[model samples]
Target: MSNVTTINPATGDQLETYAQLSQGEAFAKVDACHDAFSQWKLRSLEDRASVINGLGKALRDNKEELAQLMTAEVGKLLKDSRDEVELCAAICDYTAANGPEELADEKRDPNNAGRGIVTYSPIGVIYGIQPWNFPAYQVIRYAIANLMTGNGVLLKHAANCTGSGLKIAEIFQQGGLPDGLFTVLVIDHDTSDEIIAHDKVRGVTLTGSDDAGRHIAEEAGKALKKTVLELGSNDAYMVLEDADIDKAVGICATARLYNNGQTCIAGKRFIVTEKVYDEFVEKYVSKFAAIKTGDPTAEDTDMGPMARDDLRKTLQQQVDKSVENGAKIACGGTIPDGPGAFYPATVLTDVAPGQPAYDDELFGPVASVIKAKDDEDAMRIANDSRYGLGGGIMSKNVDRAIELASKHFDTGMVFINTFGLADPSMPFGGVKNSGYGREHGGFGVKEFANAKAIFVGAE
Candidate 1:
């Protein structure tokens, strides 16, 4: 069983190679995890929290190294990588701090005949299948919370971040935790699927594309296992006539450019009202053109290359299709002059509904600008996608903003005054083709646990 290869997308350089576990090895890990889970689930929440606290400190201390690895593995800006590492550490800290109390029971009416208290308890091992874009951050959120609930974890991080994935598994082991309490199943897709399909896995958490999410969901459904899928998004950014044009432009740049536009919830479509669409477009185009794309390892780089050559080609094909369908590029639409998978930050305008760019998620530094006659049309255009994930609404009228946000059709979460800013306190999930279940806050804790209703005096 050969290991997965890790190549830097920016320079097409092989950074490090990781070995995939054999079929027998994968089964061995599951067996070990199950054995460990049998006891881990019996541990007190306080003890679990103490261990998680140790994990949190480890993350904080290794923040710089984690950031460097993150940038080297996936093509995101250096600064963004630093912040993502910090966020990972913070989530670990949060789980260690508030988890026990969050698991506490809520006030229920005691007038029910022979009623009792609701007790929250651990289930078993949580199998986390995360993507490469935000590798360290995503796994930490799932791991810390699961461990806090006294459950062991198995991580099958993306094929790209093998080094970081291995590092994560080692960190938990070094934090004085049990051997199988936190482990990484370094295996191929088939092997990983077999591991996830194992009965002892208990539950699964996935953060990836819609296609991959659907496959995992199908397998989990067949097993009758609980699954939380944070799937892909074709999010829209709506600009009302009364929106602060300059502020909208600035935030839009950051929202779409984050992760080199590889984010599932990156603002892909720009639905702007016609009255001020021109002004917004002027500023937005200017900002897009000014973005500096370069080496992800460089500290001064604002934009990094596409995560892989295949993804870059796909992005280029999307841009080509849009242009062929009569869409005009306002800023950039081609790969930059380099050996890496670097593409310039692109802005498309006059993107008619029939254009390829209008219907598909241009999963790169490409934003399609659509014209809307009014707020009604803006919301209409935003809700026209088959993918209902996340959305953004920039407006001056607070009430209208709320109303429009509430009225969005194919969206799960809508953000006002800014783009999608995910927080551990917020309930994060998607609707429609974007998949189901959440990965943050109280919702996340329950995803890995089986809620059993305890009733008494009825026998």
Candidate 2:
């Protein structure tokens, strides 16, 4: 009987409400998904690819509606929502095109000189616990890859984006996905835990905070289920002495504010060499100050409100605590009186180890600027973090940046001279407290698969 409501963060207006599913009902849903998987897992990989191709088309056919709903639900810019849908569609395309080959059985030589076959077989059902940011893409990122592997998928999306979750299921069905193959569970945490322990759920994946990841991993561990976690980050972007200051400024500015600064892999810390520290800080603060914050649906708006009131409040408190601990605000430190959960773009300087600005992931449109003695110091500071999700290196010397990224950077993914997000062709995930495992770039297809080995005696 309990319900969850979605709101427009830009206007503080209620959008819709969805009733929560009971624990028994959620378990039944899992059973139904497993039943569907019984049949789905028997389908040819080529057939699954065809259905995935249709998913991409279906996403494109309904991109506008999906984008609008996402913007309303999470306060993401309209344009960004459209781009997110496109990215999701592209993930489907990439999976469909590459899945058959990636999941195909491989021949291997055994010690007995017999033929050994390694087959990537689909696990039963995969349970995904997703966040509100990048609603469509996050679900598609794991869901499509698993579907291509011939597994059933269950989504427990963030409560704020419940509608988006159900809509996505509808779209998959429209695209020829089998019934119960892709089910959305509108349930509370207790039910989610039960679902995770369900006999039908073969694996689990989550995109959320490090604390949440740790909890989920522990729970999944108890059940002896595999888990893939993509946790939070305070990703650092370094500006080297040989960097083009202008390009670095622009790229870092966009990277820091992308997805309204909700992206887990976004550039949150700006570590600049002493040579360009003044120049980069001046330009970066100015750019942050100029980014227009308003209604998410407006074309002229450069930034949208934070996803929720409590999230905005938490970000403000982090900024306040950071300042009290020695960090200084260069611009936008104050919370403005507004109708919605809006916070202006903020920049903090003199960010040191003790402050939240230096040590934590500020999951909002806030930037932390740190000064380093030189390129060596900047690299040292960048690699000092315990969270190694993603980071960037900006330098005029492309070769040196590549070398540094290849050898020195401790993060999972690195960007040279530019800021970037996830790509269908590249693997995404992190190490350290950012959690483990990988997704995308064909890695996701096997995350929950069983690579059974069969050997045939030589004739």
State TM-scores per candidate.
0.95, 0.99
lDDT for each residue of candidate 2 in 1-459, tens digit (9 for 90 to 100): 599999999999999999999888888899999999999999999999999999999999999999999999999999999999999999999999999999999999999867999999998999999999889999999999999999999999999999999999999999899999999999999888888888889899999999999899999999999999999999999999999999999999999999998899999999999998999999999999999999999989999999999999999999999999999999998888969999999999999998988999999999999999999999999988889999999999999999999999999999998786999989999999998999999899999999999999988
Model 2 misplaced regions, further than 4 Å: none
Clashing residue pairs, candidate 1? 3-19, 3-20
| Predicted structure with the largest TM-score when compared to the true one | 2
Residue range 162-214, candidate 1, lDDT tens digits: 88888877777767678887888888888877877787888888888888988
Q: Which ten residues in a row have the lowest lDDT in candidate 1?
A: 105-114
How well does candidate 1 score on lDDT at residue 416? 89
> What lDDT would candidate 1 get against the real structure?
0.83
- lDDT scores of the candidates, listed in order: 0.83, 0.94
Query: lDDT winner among the candidates?
Result: 2
What is the TM-score (0 to 1) of candidate 2? Answer: 0.99
